[model samples]
Target: MKLYPIESGNFKLDGGAMFGVVPKSLWHRTNPADANNMIDIAARCLLIEDGNRLILIDTGMGDKQSDKFLGYYYLWGNDTIDKSLKKYGFHRDDITDVFMTHLHFDHCGGSVQWNKDRTGYEPAFKNALFWSNKDHWLWATQPNNREKASFLKENILPMEESGQLNFVSLPETEILKNSELGFDIFFANGHTDKQMIPIITYKDMKICFMADLLPTAGHLPLPYVMGYDTRPLLTLDEKEAFLNLAANDNFYLFLEHDAHNEIITVQHTEKGVRLKDVYSCSDLF
Candidate 1:
């Protein structure tokens, strides 16, 4: 198995929203904000090449939203899925699976694109099976008022309409071992309903796709949950348990939203679990 870091794009978001109730004085130290109080964010997706199956985890924010809509996020950078795939000598058509951690526009938006005629939207990866769980699929499709803005219909629906959508079976326990995607899935709910965090084994080390469960190394603190999370209290519990496990087992966390820090590991400290080390994608994959 081979892993490639796919740089979809970069954008800036309000630091306050990203760090929730955490005081700017604290979070700003790690994730410094610009003059506009916006911090750099990355839609760093992951690509897995195992045998003939080329699986992509998250597609970033596609270039389909109107300028007005995209402007709100302060989009930056020249990275695109096409350019990143080409860097690895691959293309979207070579992807066999597009596994979405959640249906948020920034995570799965690139899964759909405007057709050649620009008449309607269509699946971005023509040959890929778009993956989501039944719970998250329903949660995103029938979104609540708070999350409605993040779940854009143009970024979704087309996968199912194209007859390429598939759902991973929900696990009875916190972790689902040996999933259909050839990895273990850690189910988390605090961020959103049934957010699936992929736990992959490579070279005898577990590389966990940290999704929103732990957006960045700065979010290692249990109470440093995102304001966007529906259940912030529940997020505290999930992070505590997951961080403990990650520290104990020495798991390499693959952060998807951290623009600067690519991969990191945590260790037990007097202040609880804290960042132990940082690594570039090349160090592991």
Candidate 2:
């Protein structure tokens, strides 16, 4: 199996929103904010090349939002979905599966695009079987008012309309057994309901798509939950339990939003599992 980091580009969000109730004086030292208090974040996706199944983890913030909407996030980057895929000798059409971590725009925006002549929204990868549990689908489609703006209909619906949407069984409360691919699913609610974190085994090492659970090294602290979370307290509980297991088993956290750091380790420190080191994903291979 081969893995590639698909650079879906970067966007900005209020640092306060990203780091939650943490004071600026505290988080600024870790992930510095711009003069406007907006912080740069990457929409990093993972591509799995296993047999004929080319699975893409998440789509980046697509270029479909209006200019005013783009102004808010300050989306700036040269690397795009197609460009990133081309780097690995693949194309959008080659993708066979799109495993949406959740329906948040930044995570799944690139899943669909405006049709030719700007007719209507359509599946970005027409051939890929887009995967999301029924629960997440319902949550995103009928989003709560608090998160309605982030769950843009233009980025969703088209997957089902394209007739390629599928749902994986929810993992049991107990640590899930690996699928045939030798990877287990870790569910966490801090970020979203039933968000699935793929625990992949490769080359005698374990790697997990940390998703929003541990977005970056700066987010290692138990108090660093994002203010954007619907249930910040629930995020706290979920993060602590997940981090403890990750530190104990020495898993490589494959960060989905960290632009500078790709993989990180957590040491069982007095303050709980603190980030031990940062390395590129290539180091894992």
Candidate 3:
């Protein structure tokens, strides 16, 4: 399978929020912040081509929200979902699957957009099957107060309404069986309950979509869990296990939220697991 780096857009997030409990002196070294303490973040995704399927994993935040709503996040950058797709000689409709890591706005917002008339919402990838696990689907649809703001109904419901919404069954007997998608699905609850990280195998290399599990290279350490994670302790456990596995196995981490680093490897340091090397996708392939 061929993988294309599809950059949708960039936005600024509060550095403190991104790196919970971690001091600014520590995180700012890698992800420097502005006067307002906001750091640049990328909604970087991938386009996967295998056989007859063209899967676009996690479209970035779309342009459907109100200006004021977007202003809060301080969205920036020239890279757009359509333009990046065009770079690979593809379009929105060409995607056969919209594999969402989770239904958070930045990850799944671009899956829906305003129809021409400005009257209603519609699926951005009309021909694609919108993919998410059933439990997370319910969590997002009927969001709790802590996550209600991140799970926008407009960005999510349109897929189910379009009759294209489908679930990757997670039976207790076969929980880690890769979710019927070709890639291995790493179920992480630290970010959200049942969030799936697609561990994709390509060209004799293991490329993993480090959804919110490892938002940026700065977040490589096992303890650098996000303040936004509801289950921070669980995140600590998950990161330690995942990072150790990545380091030992020499896996390429496909960072989804880091604006600068595309892929990185980890080294076991005295302090903890740290970034060993940074490279772009082209460098690897």
Those runs of model 1 whose alpha carbons end farther than 4 Å from true positions after fitting are none
TM-score leader? 1
* Candidate 2 lDDT tens digits, 188-225: 77677777788887767788888887877889899999
Winning candidate number (lDDT):
1
**Which rank order by lDDT, best down to worst?**
1, 3, 2
lDDT of each prediction vs. the true structure? 0.94, 0.85, 0.90
Q: How close is candidate 3 to the true structure, as a TM-score?
A: 0.97
Instruction: Write model 3 residue lDDT over 153-257, tens digit each, in one string.
Output: 999999999999988877563125655668888888888888888888898889999999999999987778898998999999888888888889988999999
Off by over 4 Å in 3: 171-175
Which is superior by lDDT, 1 or 2? 1
Q: What is the model-wide C-alpha lDDT for candidate 1? A: 0.94
Q: What would the per-residue lDDT of candidate 1 be over residues 163-198, giving only the tens digit for each residue?
A: 999999899899999889999999999989999999
What does candidate 2 score in Cα RMSD to the true structure?
Answer: 1.4
